[model samples]
Target: MSTDEHLDPIPDSFILQPPVFHPVIPYGTTIFGGLYAGKMVTLQGVVPLHARRFQVDFQCGCCLHPQPDVAFRFSPRFYTVKPHVICNTHQGGLWQKEIRWPGVALQRGDSFLILFLFENEEVKVSVNGQHFLHYRYRLPLSRVDTLDISGDILVKAVGFLNINPFLLYSPRLEVPCSRALPRGLWPGQVIVVRGLVLKEPKDFTLSLKDGTTHVPVTLRASFTDRTLAWVSSWGRKKLISAPFLFHPQRFFEVLLLCQEGGLKLALNGQGLGATSLDQKALEQLRELRISGNVHLYCVHC
Candidate 1:
């Protein structure tokens, strides 16, 4: 799998009992969930073209308002006097000096995903699948009961996942992967695919079907002489093509979010659509099957 496509399996603890996420919010919101040392928090959003700055913080309390001690703060500034990102801590009514990075890979008007994995000694952070920063433990994780996000970014989803030790040590599904869907489609159910597209490949198919009959949906990505993969859905012998393909073989993570309406697509963290379902075939969508040239590392539904 490509480095960009690499993502740790979200585990049963996360997918089945994920933290109550405020899926979509304005530029700011307050989250009230105390985090533990082994928990991971994930957030997805977009950076508008005119964005100047945005921040995410884990604080002592939400009701504490302005004076709560902030365990960690992640702020990315695009149009400030100096374009940079700041990582800092706040305590005793004062903010400490920040650890700053001068440049950023996030593009304006593009979607992004950020993950904060709390460890015993440090908070490891990743942005858009790439390691970004590491902040030493300054305040106790037990005191962090709230998450505050504010700035120009449009928030899409924010949630936390508890780590399970047994799952962590279990065997992983290697390449050429295929698996059965847990319980068919249900709202709030999410299927996550993490893998690398083959560097030199012709085509690949990621599929879902009813165990008794034909495939209800087949995600086919075909390449020609160029480096693009024509991504689309093939079902009931019909194909619907996306306008473009995400860069291949460089690491990719695709998430299929089942909602009341249908499927919400996110490729490498950027959301695509919540297209309505073709109920005839969708209602019976029962099994997940992957057979393609791509190297499938991890799949969780």
Candidate 2:
């Protein structure tokens, strides 16, 4: 899949997370107003250690009723003939020719994130942030009213995010700045920062702090120390190699995903940030400050 298939960072509205369905096998749920172009469904979970097979289906009607039409069936098998994943359509309870994709990206006892983004002609699927498959619409997209996932897997979260709206694509902003997060620092929300390092810079810091007092959680990338560091008052500060040393003048983007435990950080796709962001941090997190020697371009929280 092309990078264009991925959802944009600046969102007019956020994803709507539905309640997780645990131990869901042969389980199904209604897709409100039916599925459509520009609608996206995301699933995150773990593949059981002893997993045999799993299937996620988008259907006009579920198998609970007879003769249900399955628009898209994503069935991945582990102990199958060749251990491959198949994509197919089932109409009038009859199956179509299967399209096979090799390589089982999900191993036993591993977690995975799956995203299905619908477009006019096809549904783009990505597994663990990597493009997995794309299925052209043999049946009308609007006919898909229910989503069903069955077989061996542990379900954690299922959510929907709309990409049809014209969310304000916040252009670049000035650096050495303190800016408010788009929707405040809430769990499930994401913060995206884009910028370039200054030539011969010693360091730069990105801090998220409370509105009033400056009790802050800072991520500092230092050339002098030759490390990318993380610091909060409580947890042990984490430091690693200084990529900025050779990356000066090169553009970069950082993404922060707020979770229950803490803020999970990523540069491009590499994991960063280490520390538990406690209740106090959530209650007070209000301002995002960027300082030091860097040219800030975009900050979309």
Give lDDT tens digits, candidate 2, residues 68-186. Answer: 88899898888765567899999877899999988858777878877788988999998876788888989998899898988988886666655443322434467688777534577
Candidates in order, TM-scores: namely 0.62, 0.60
lDDT of 1 by residue, 89-158 (tens): 9998899988997666676787877878888889998777678888897888878877778877887666
Every candidate's lDDT:
0.67, 0.72
Which stretch of 10 consecutive residues in model 2 shows the poorest summed lDDT?
A: 12-21
Number of the predicted model whose TM-score against the real structure is largest: 1
* Candidate whose lDDT is highest: 2
**Model 1 regions more than 4 Å off:** 1-33, 106-111, 159-165, 171-206, 220-261, 265-272, 290-301
